[model samples]
Target chain A: MPSAAGPLKTTALTRLFRDMGARMVDFAGWELPVQFSSVLEEHQAVRTAAGLFDVSHMGEVEVRGRAALEVVQKLTSNDVSRLGPGQAQYTALTTDKGTFVDDIIVYRRDEDDFLAPIRSFHFIETAVGGTKCIVARTGYTGEDGFEIYAPPGDALDLFSALVREGSPHGLLPCGLGARDTLRLEARLLLYGNDLDETTTVLEAGLDSIVKLGKGPFIGSEALTREKERGPLRRLMGFEMIDAGIPRHGYPIRVEGAETGAVTSGTFGPTVKKSIGLAYFPSRAAGVGTRFSVGIRGRDAQAVIVPTPFYRRAH
Target chain B: MSKGNGIYPEDLKYTKEHEWLAVNGGVGTVGITHYAQSELGDIVYVELPAAGSPVVAGEEFGTVESVKAVSEIFAPVSGEVLEVNTALATSPETINKDPYGDGWLLKLKLADSKELDALMTAAEYRKYIEEEAN
Candidate 1:
């Protein structure tokens, strides 16, 4: 039987990606390239040079009305009042328990207009190679790059144009595989992997975005209470001290017993080590804390470490 | 990748699982096919049974880990493990760069020379992969 949701959705650049011999995979119900050349190579390119990525699967929303700010402010955890015209910030739509509905970027285009506030967006609306797109100085990867929000029809053209221009400068077309490794190295949390509605913002260590003094909003009550009580579990970073790649859902052990679960883990190509993120008891989540990650049913030694494992030189 | 030179040597016998065996006397050297390595992308780790271990034909003997996934390595024919490619422990990318030569995973003292007849010829394996792709 066919899936009730139907077949996977394809981005405008899907055909082009296939034509370029990219290896495709299913990601969040969308057909996207996992890699073109290789994950390691593409990751290095983005770190040292540049890489183009098709993130059209990310949803977009726009709001323009007198009550837009009132609604957005009430819905998001970040201080919407801080955003002036043509500004953006990473924020989250909170559940009633102060957990994430989704982590989003709020782009305030004007006094009562916000454009492209979803998973990612920056602060600019521009054109590239005659194709109009909302070019935001934002990316999931830690590198200084832009996420171009182009119309479905213009996506292929804009991608091609960027590739043509960037080819001489050594820009490889990256895929979701490279995107994942890059973000993990930067300690950027992925929703399904590192966070969910069951985990609160305080627990996720995103207090910077939660404005308790901004007056009551959807999740303010729970957030305030949680803040007073302190988070029970704290998400932290760790690296493998032994051979084996820590993977998502792997069991984390404090000694010989299960303590927490690995949320997102990978061989960070840039860091040249196996690194991961997991939630542990706040008391034991400090850096230099030793732990074990079970890989293929065998516990491997690991150690808690400071996050954002790779920082780009300014 | 390069699809590995697009050559499957006629001197070897192949399994449907994409492993190849070069039999000389009672010993058979084994490795994954070029098609297998190319499909697997970059190999980052290889886990093999230690020498003196016995492996049964059609059973998993070890594993190969790439950046994105882990694949079990299946034995082509029953044999006693003679040696493993220790270099792959630190430099597994050799499987991606040279799957046939330096990337050879294991050597076995054959348990059943007759089992080799059940595997495919290079030409037959080539046809098998072509069908698998479609």
Candidate 2:
């Protein structure tokens, strides 16, 4: 629990992070490790070998009933009917207006049981002192990984077990800083930074998962209409050509005219350049389109580039 | 080769912003302290001002960017920039690898030599950071 101005809430691995000399920061009301060794080192560790992360702050919701699949199908954009037990699918809970409620990963445990990963709030009841627990192969980073759900009391033990098991593979304990850079290099969309309630799935370039031909679900009608009408704005990737680092909320301009604002921006470790995502008018959102980003009161030259900036060799 | 916590050089002056100034014959070499680089975590970019730029004491002169965030670097003493470390342009990780040596950011020709007296001695800086941690 967090007070008004006190310290943020901690996960089970918080003490372990401190013991390892991690630098902590308040993220989404949780006191999480931003880095232990260094962001660059941890990021390279994940790319070349493997890095472990304490993502216990992510929320879990268990839906168990005869209508479990129906409830999930009604709420998410992906085709839930295609998911068999023990499988997981990336999805988004959309509003009636075809905008995001939240992006999530749904794990179908059984015909009547499903687990959805959210931003906050842990579903520890299903993990501890319960009959069944489902571990799913899912991650926000564009690497192969698994997210484990366990009871709050069991979190420490689980984390320790993972550390012990993964030690031989040169697994280092990673933190949020490495996580952000790795995901950004992969061009994954962050919820608050990339998608919001007012931003439609089509506009966010997530049309593959929006199966319109499937039977109706929440926001299906609006999404269908959107499919017919096309999106007004599109999220695009950009790399800085001139010297300057673009930051979130920086103005994106075209020929001295303000066009859009950067949604997320950072110096990508893998890419070895400053990269970012921003909304551009559909007409100007083509690959190689030149523009400028406002960085430190100066217009830095930039150009739209293809996404998934650094894809791992599969 | 230097000693003292294996990071902070005992003879250098430090700023509250975590910058260090090694003054030699009224010309000071400026760089971020070991604490700054450790806190920043794998610096990916260092934005430096051009040579001959006038830098005022306690004012932001440049920025140091890590993967997670960007931080402004403040000048420890009033001076004119003599040279900027161009090596950092292609290899910013030098700040993390050798913050005190190869990572030195800039060389400044001091405008007021006495300004160096206002900066904290290494012992005072160590104490100051310890207090801040508490």
* Candidate 1 CAPRI category: acceptable
List, residue by residue over A261-302, the lDDT tens digit for candidate 2.
999888887778889999998889999999999888878899
- Among the numbered candidates, top lDDT falls to 1
Each model's TM-score, in the order given? 0.93, 0.90
Model 2, position A249: C-alpha lDDT score: 93
Query: Interface RMSD computed for candidate 2 is what?
Result: 5.8
Which digits, one per residue and each the tens of the lDDT, describe model 1 over residues A102-149? Answer: 999988885343455433344666566787666678888898877777
Model 2, stretches more than 4 Å misplaced?
A1-7, A111-133, B1-6
lDDT of 1: 0.87
Minimum summed lDDT over a 10-residue window in model 2 chain B is located at: B1-10
Model 1 alpha-carbon miss at residue A249, Å: 1.8
Per-model tally of clashing residue pairs: 0, 0
Best by DockQ: 2
TM-score of 1: 0.93
Per-residue lDDT tens digits of candidate 1, residues B60-131? 999887777778889999999999999999899998888779999999999988898899999999888887
Candidate 1 ranges with C-alpha deviation above 4 Å: A1-4, A111-122, B1-5
Per-residue lDDT of B36-57 in model 2, one digit per residue for the tens? 8876767888898999999999
